[model samples]
Every structure is written in structure tokens, then in C-alpha cells.
Target chain A: MEIPDKSATAPDFAEPPVFAEPWHAELFAMTVHLHKQGLFSWLDWTAQLSEALAAAGKHHTLDGGDDYYAVWLDTLLQIMIAQGVTDDSSVQAMQEQWRNAYVRTPHGKPVRLADDGAD
Target chain B: MPHEHDDHNAHSLLPSEPALRVRALETILTRKGLVSAETLDEIIDVYAHKIGPHIGAKIVARAWIDSDFKQALLTNAESILGEMKLAGRQGEHVQVVENTANIHNMVVCTLCSCYPWPLLGIPPSWYKSDAYRKRAVREPRAVLAEFGITPSQTQSVRVWDSTAEMRYLVLPMMPVAAAGCDEATLARWVTRDCMVGTGIPKAPQI
Candidate 1:
């Protein structure tokens, strides 16, 4: 694939990237967050999820989009958080801590925290 | 202690799950030394894209639109990600790389498919290609050029080789038209391959 000139473009703010755990663990965590927030009742999430997975199964045996599902699950959690679902203290605490620790950073020039001056 | 060393040795002696799986597969191809790499590739392909990139795309999309949130994303991706609580499963060292005019960056885990599932989601197919991994560092411009991204002569292309300890995701620059768009709408323009710096965001319709 020919790489396009991204310099011609401006930066898009996708979710900031952070590395603390594995993808599936993140997926699982998001799902739990959703449940805690009550965006989707445990029963409803399981049902809709199973249905989506099942539907995905007919086309591709492996649910390759498990990460996507994790995102979908995360989206649900965000929606619930936005919608004022459960708001369990544990979930709120986690979100708060996450917000403080990982999410908030000064924009521009890629925060220099990770890069040590020395090679 | 020596006991710890011995335990480490014992653990090392035990084959990892992926190693075990590979060996099991090799056993099936025992007659032929050339095991079809495609088989393993296929499996990884399904997992990386179907599950990984899909989740990542959402994170990237959301960051593009939300300012206070975008600031949060850039400052400390891991912990902020912990808010979404989606860090850690396969990709533990997920790092975000923001693309800029003077320079362009992309990531490649040449050794393995280490990725930032919590943020960018699953990686794309070309990300795992030998051609990309081998040449990205040596000839980044050419490699990215192949993907339709041509950085200026003055622009320095830095390729971050991903490792188990450090993975990368691109905080792709937002499109000009994305000014008033909602996160979900803007996400439509953030393609998975683009997040990895292998492609550009789709042009807005006139």
C-alpha cells in the first residue's frame, strides 16, 4: 500500500494509546465497566453480545473482532456513563483514577515522558 | 535467589501456549519441513483485525473529537485508558504516537504482533507483513510511500519497533472538516490501517 502524506493532514484525536495490560483483559474490563454502569443489563448485554458473536460466527468462525467487541462493550460503558446508568463507586473510582493517570496529558509534540534522552 | 533462578529456568523449560500451539501444528506438518505459514497467519489475521483493530478504532475516533478528552488521551494513555478500563490483555505496552507535519511516525512489532488494543484496537494485516517490518525502519519513506503516505524531504520518518514491553498506536491528526463532527461521525473517517500510519484518512465528500 502506498503511504499517503499524513503531514498534509492534521492529527485526529482517537483514543490516546496506553499500555498497561493485555487486549483481552482490557476487553473484559470494559465489559465489566458496562455492567457496573448499567448501560446494558447483564442479561441484555449477554444476550445482544451472544447474538452479535453468533451472527459474526456464521460469516467467520473466529470472532476476530473480539477487540472490536471490547470497544463496542466499552462504548456501551461510555454510553451508560453518559446516560447515568449504575454509577457504582468502584466503576467511578476506576474511571476517575484512569482519567487522572492516563487520559489527561498536554497536547502537542507527543508527551516526552516515555522517551529518555539517552539512547 | 538460586531458588528463583531455578523457578525461572523451570518456567522457561515449559513451552508457552503459542509455542505449544506452534509445535502442535508443526507435528501435523512433520512430513514436510515447510509448514504453511499461512495457517498461523490466518489465525492471527482473524484475531488482530476482527477483535483488535475494531476496538482500537473506537478509541482513536473518540480522541479526535473530544478536546478535554483528547488532552487526557495524550497525557497518560495507559491510566486514562484505565478509565475505559480496557488496557491489558494481549497488548500491554500500548503507546500513542501523534502524527505531525514536520514528522510522521508509524509502529511495527517486527518480532510479534504486539499492539495497543485498549486504544487503537486490533492491528491490520500489513502491519504483520515481513516486507513492512523489515523495511519500515530502513526505508520508512519508501515503506509509507507504498501505503500512499509520502512525508516531505525535510520531514524525518521515525519507525518505532514494537516489543512486548512497548507497543504503539498512532494518534492520527484530525481532518480539517472534522471540526464540528461528533466522535462517532469522525470515527467513520478513522480507518484501522490509517491508525497504524499505513494509510490516510478518507477525504471528506464535497
Candidate 2:
């Protein structure tokens, strides 16, 4: 199957476009999905994110880059942990697994949990 | 999990840490049946294709032609937008501020990038930039000038700070050259910057 070139069709704007990276869009979609699943209310999500931003603001400027979404990812984890949806250890372990999987997968291939099992 | 790497070149292909982290989170959540990949794809598709400034422009065009809609939009935008099936998620609470002869309105989120996503899609990078967030509230006129909009000295600039609680969309004044034009034509003149108060619709050439 052939994939269309998204960059070729994207509109040119004076400034950088939102969702500069695919993961940014994925993170946003996951938050919305989790919110829709009754994991947390939108208000709660915003409050937690607001608090996270406030805390991060003290240490560095929020430039809406990886750092901004890093705070978002942290806020999401914090909420999930606080709500007993998932524990810190499990997430950490899973992250380690993914890191290993990513390191084993070849270039331009999708990283999968099964790839981690090859070891 | 082992830390052994079979492919040395794979290290160079590793995505950013946050990228890997998000992928892990999604994988865990999906395995636990908390989130469906299809739903995630649907949401991303909607934002990337279906939603954008074009929707907001259509609404603004209707307001430009209809006095009653303009009044209803300003008075109670949430319900009005809900009626149009445009109310959701980031647009739960909305306020439409009008630009007139005497007053000019601009929006920024001092806390974070809180915007009316259903109407405007994802915000522009500049909107979420540190410089814009800090300067927009401090000196809106100068910021507007940077966007090539120099609101006359007679006009008072009102900078609204958006929060997750409420989002603001600027209703730019219709250009004189657009008089008697249809709603579609008027909408063509309304750009994302116009709705964000950084730019105004230029007069359409006949």
C-alpha cells in the first residue's frame, strides 16, 4: 500500500503547525480517549494539567514543545495512578520493555511488544 | 525484559523519550481494555481533517449577515454553538467577543494552550509559544502590529486569557468591501488569524 505524503499537502503557515510530532497527536488522542472512558472527567484532567504546568513553570519556561507534553504525560500518569487505574511500577516496567523493544526493532519498522520477546 | 540490542543501528532510530513513553502508556492502556486504538484514530482523524478554522469562519459569516444570530452568538455562545452541533470537549464553554469600531479583542491562554478546538482545530504553534503567551497580555496592540494589524489608537484592545473553563473566539468585523456578499464568500475572507484577532479579513477584490 502506498501512503500519501502528508508534508507535501500540508498548508504553509507563518509559524510551525501544531502536532509537530506524531506522538504529540497520539498523546492528545489518548487523553481524549481516556477521558471518554470515564477514567477522569475533563475538569479533573484540566485541573491536574494546570497544576502540573504550574509546577513545571517554576523550573523552566513552557514552550509548548516536548517539555509541555512531557508535563501532560506526567499529569496523565499521575491521574491514572491516583485513580488506581495503574500503578507506577507497572508503567515503569512497561516503559522499560518498550525501550528495549524499540532498541531491538529495525529502522522504519513498527515497535511491538512481541519484538521485546525475541530476546 | 533484556537490554540486549540485536541491531546497533536501532539506537539511532529511537524516537524521543516522550514519544516512547506515550507509546508505552497507550500500549498498556489498550491491553487493559481502557482505550481502543480505533477511537484514537477516529479522534485524530476528526481533528486533522474535519475540524478547523473553516467551521469557525462559517459561523462568523452567518453572524456577519444575520443580526439575530450575531446577538445570540454573543449573548450565549455555548447553547448557540451546541445547537449547531459544534459544542464538545474543549468547546464546552465558549464566549464570542466581537470586534467593533471602538473595541478590538484578542485571545491567549496565559496558563496553557486552552483553545476552542472544535472550532479552530489545534492551535497554531505561535499561539502556544512563550513569547506570544507573555507578550499578548502585556502589550496586545504591539503584538497585533507584529501580525500586521495595527488597531487604531481610538480602539481599545481587550486581551482575553482563555482557561479550560472558558474559551474565547474573536468575531472580526466584516470588511466594507464584503457588503452584500453571500455567506460563503464572506467566510472565504475569514482566516484563522482573523478569528484569533491577529489579523483581519482583507477586502475581497471584486
Candidate 3:
């Protein structure tokens, strides 16, 4: 991703789509909710989200949802670790599961762990 | 019955390339410690259960009952909304477009999916699709038609494009059946599509 340096404004990225993917809402709400809980202040969230935006742009991976949320999820996880709220391994494991689920699911099914037998 | 084991699916453990890349960055960030799964789940649950388009319904109902509120909504929506304790969040600027006999409004973020999140909890998945973004602006009538709304040809079609600074909500024409209804009951008639200008509110059956 294009991690913009300090003093660099974000590129003219498209405004977030209004009706976006479920994952985007999940990431967006989680970010908002965490900020509300004082996990990180708005300033911290902005900087992190901005960095994610730039990075996603750099990698040609920013989409309306997937990459966008993925970047956001990474930023939140990173900030939490920086603040000692959480660690890398925990989020890493979770992300791995989500990623795996997303990859293996059919084109139109919910992402889930392969070992998860229940619907 | 044979023991049901998740048989070999070699690719099952692997994520999409983009997903892997994100996981890798996450790994790098917290190489030392971990964030709790509970935190993430708590946040997700709140959004899943608590938020939706109901807030927008309240605003629409208020506008219906009070002309002054409607005037305030059209002229100074941000402050008025703030007075109702809804200041724009995430750098949002909001405006409301009223549907009239001669004009029908629709909203699209041609550049992206900018929306009034404070009013409507989250934009639906369909709103963010490239198809809706590209086609809604160019062929709003056709798009609306697909949604089963065919505004008369004489009614002007106004398409509002959202930006990071500004977003829109459509104030649909209140139906005659709702004339004597209470605000909460009337609010029920205001669907999300009404605010997007693709649908009209239907009054309750007496």
C-alpha cells in the first residue's frame, strides 16, 4: 500500500460507497466502536486509517470493501499493539481464519472455518 | 454413519492473496502481544443489533409534523441535526432533498460511496456497488424503474452526488393516508429507499 508520509494528504480516493460490502461495515463499525471505547483517540484512528488508505492505494488493492476493510482491520490491530491493548499473534490468527474462510467459500456463501461443521 | 471429518481441502487453510497480505501486516504489528477477540466481537455485536435506518425515519417523521423543522432541515440541516444531537461524524456534511410534485431526487456518490452515516446507520451493500454508482447517475429513471418506481416524465429528476464533505438524504413526499397518524406510526412508512428516492412511503392501513 502507498503509506503517505507525514504532511502528505491522501490521494483523491473515492468517497466510501454508501451501500458497501458487509465486511466494510464490520470494519467501519469496529473502528468507530473502538474509538468510542477509548481504545485509540480519533487522531490516532485518523492517522492509522489514512496510512491504511495510502498503503492500500500503493498495493493496488483498495476496493470498495475487501482491501479497504482489510487495511482498516490491520491498522486497528496495529494501533492496539502499539498501545499495548493487544498483540500481533492474536489478531494474526483471527485474520488468518477470516482470510482462509473467505478464500475457500464458494462465490456466494458466507466465509467460515472449514472445520466448522455447523451452518 | 461414517465419521464425518472435514476431508482434505488443501486450499482451505490459505487466504486470498490480499487477505494474506493484510494478515502479514497485522502479524508484524503485534509480533509481541495480542488484542482480545472479545473487543472485536463486542464492537461487532453493537452495530449488528443497535444501528439501522430508524434514525432517518424519526427525522422524516419530525419533518412531516412540523413545517418549521422541515424548513430548518432544508435550510440548515447540519446544525438542526446537531441540535437533535447528530453532528456529522467522520467529516460528513449532510443535506436533505425534498421530493415534490415536479421534482424527484436520487442520491449517488459517483466518486465513491459517501453517505450520511449518522442519519442512516450504514449504507446498504447495494449502495456501494459499482453498478449502482455508475448507472444511478446516468440512468436514474431507469434505475428507479427497476426498483418499481417510475416517476412521471414531467417530474424533474435530480441526482445528488455525494462527496467526503457533503452527502444527501431524500425527503420523500408523505402520503395522504398518513395525514392523521402519529409520528412513530408515520415513521414506519418511510423506508430506506424513500430516503434514497427510489421508493415512496406507504401509509398504514386503517
Local error of candidate 2 at residue A95 (angstroms):
1.9
Tens digits of per-residue lDDT, candidate 2, A1-119, equal: 22233432233234354578888889899998888877777778888887788788788777777778889899998888888878888888878888777686677776677644332
Show model 1 residue runs off by greater than 4 Å.
Answer: A1-119, B1-50, B119-122, B203-206
Per-residue lDDT of model 3, residues B62-142, tens digit only = 899999999999998999988887767665679999999999999987644567777776666566555676689899999
What is the descending lDDT order? 2, 3, 1
Q: Which wins on TM-score, candidate 2 or candidate 3?
A: 2
Best by TM-score: 2
Of all true interface contacts, what fraction is found in model 1? 0.00
Which stretches of model 2 miss by more than 4 angstroms? A1-17, A115-119, B1-7, B10-12, B203-206
* Candidate 1 chain A, poorest ten consecutive residues by summed lDDT: A110-119
DockQ of 2: 0.34
* Off by more than 4 A, model 3: A1-26, A30-119, B1-39, B204-206
Give one digit per residue, the lDDT tens place, for model 1 in A1-119: 22233432333334323222233433434444434444455445544544444444455443233333433444444444455543445354433433332223333222211222221
Alpha carbon lDDT at B193, candidate 1 = 70
Candidate ordering by DockQ (highest first): 2, 3, 1
TM-score of each: 0.48, 0.86, 0.64
